[model samples]
Target: MARQLAVALTGAPGPAHRVTLSEVVAQASALAVSGTRTLLGISGAPGAGKSTVVEAILAELGPRAAWVPMDGFHLDNGVLEGLGRRGRKGAWDTFDVEGYVALLQRVRDLPAADAVVYAPALDRSLETAVAAAIPVPAEASLVLTEGNYLLHDAGGWEQVRPLLDQVWFLEVPEQERVRRLLGRRTQDGEALEQARAWVHDVNQVNAGLVLADAHRADLRLRLTTRGDDSAGGSGR
Candidate 1:
């Protein structure tokens, strides 16, 4: 695992003391073996690779860890349309912030050895949330949840941070993050112009909200693509 993380960080430009992916994994591993259910959050603006980092850590940790993304708490498209928020689908108000906080509280309080907690999942293709789609079992000591609003402090979202044991915020260059958002929208079958419009009009607005409370995160990770620098540290 260390070798894989080392290779992933190799050739990335950053300070000599940059925290490696291995260290991140180590932190997660420590939580998993702590003999208690731990919830670790990964947060970032849209396109900041929150899912990518969470998936990598889960892959390394294997069966001891489980994923519970906050995307599952997104309000149904119908609900959004009824609320007249369909045009700004990814905004913080588009999510069921109260429901998400309730789930986090349940996950944090319930003993992993007692029962299975079913979490909802987001069907990106359909852009709707599916209930009871993800099962967090008895043995999964570390629950990793990633999303854009874990650090957000308003609109009923301020309750989320206290439930998490640790949170890592991903920091990607704005240009790169915007590029990824555009690519994702286009890949989801939007026309180029439509994708551009959505990225600028909808996603970027939400991104601003997520980035505002980033300082509350326990760790801040600067993840970059090939030819870019990788850097991160505790509260940096």
Candidate 2:
């Protein structure tokens, strides 16, 4: 099996092995054949391109891999509103961590012969969680889960780390991250200043927590750009 790296060997930097997105996907695809089911985690601060990596991986290994986002377990908006946490919706406390862990356990315990297990997905457009929107078929050997807190240790978040076969932390420049985050906040009709303010007050606080523990990841990948549909760039 070949190793996937983010550096290319020839073109730009000497002694560096720059790899393409396809290279990484190929290596991840190879993991499905490793006997046991593989749970590969991609963790990073918000706006660090975690979802992009998952999208790229899923596109590369459809059916063989399924995405189980931590965002799907986000607490309902009304619940947050009731608790006065509506202003900071993406905080770790705003999510149902136990529920996510349970779903992950099911993904591990159930075999390919069993009926597909349904998983919820976050409807960011509606700012709500939609239940049982994605099904994990019996044949999927790779479960790709991403979020801001897979590596987070507070309030039982540490328990999340041991369940995965591998984990990678995504890195994006702070300025670029802030830019991307502001773009997202504005997508929902926030004014430019409002977006920046929320990012500084809300998003950065959470990002601080994520960055503090990035070194604990199995691999640290600094992406060249945010590679999702709403964003694009050359990735390292």
User: lDDT tens digits, residues 1-236, model 1?
Assistant: 43433344343423222345656677678778888888899898888777777777899989889888899999998999999999998788999888888888877777646687889999987888999998887688999999999988889988999999787777777777887888787777889999999888998888888888777777666653333564222111
Q: Give the TM-score of candidate 1.
A: 0.86
* Cα-based lDDT for every prediction: 0.78, 0.77
RMSD of each: 5.9, 5.1
Give the TM-score (vs. native) of candidate 2. Answer: 0.87
lDDT of 2 by residue, 51-158 (tens): 777888998888889888899999998999999999998888999999998898888887768668888999978979999998887788898899989988888787
Reference-based lDDT, residue 33, model 1:
86
Clashing pairs in 2: 6-19, 7-17, 7-18, 7-19, 8-17, 8-18, 112-138
Error of 1 at 53 (Å): 1.0
lDDT, model 2, position 13: 23
Off by over 4 Å in 1: 1-23, 112-114, 224-227, 230-236
Q: What is the TM-score of each candidate against the true structure?
A: 0.86, 0.87
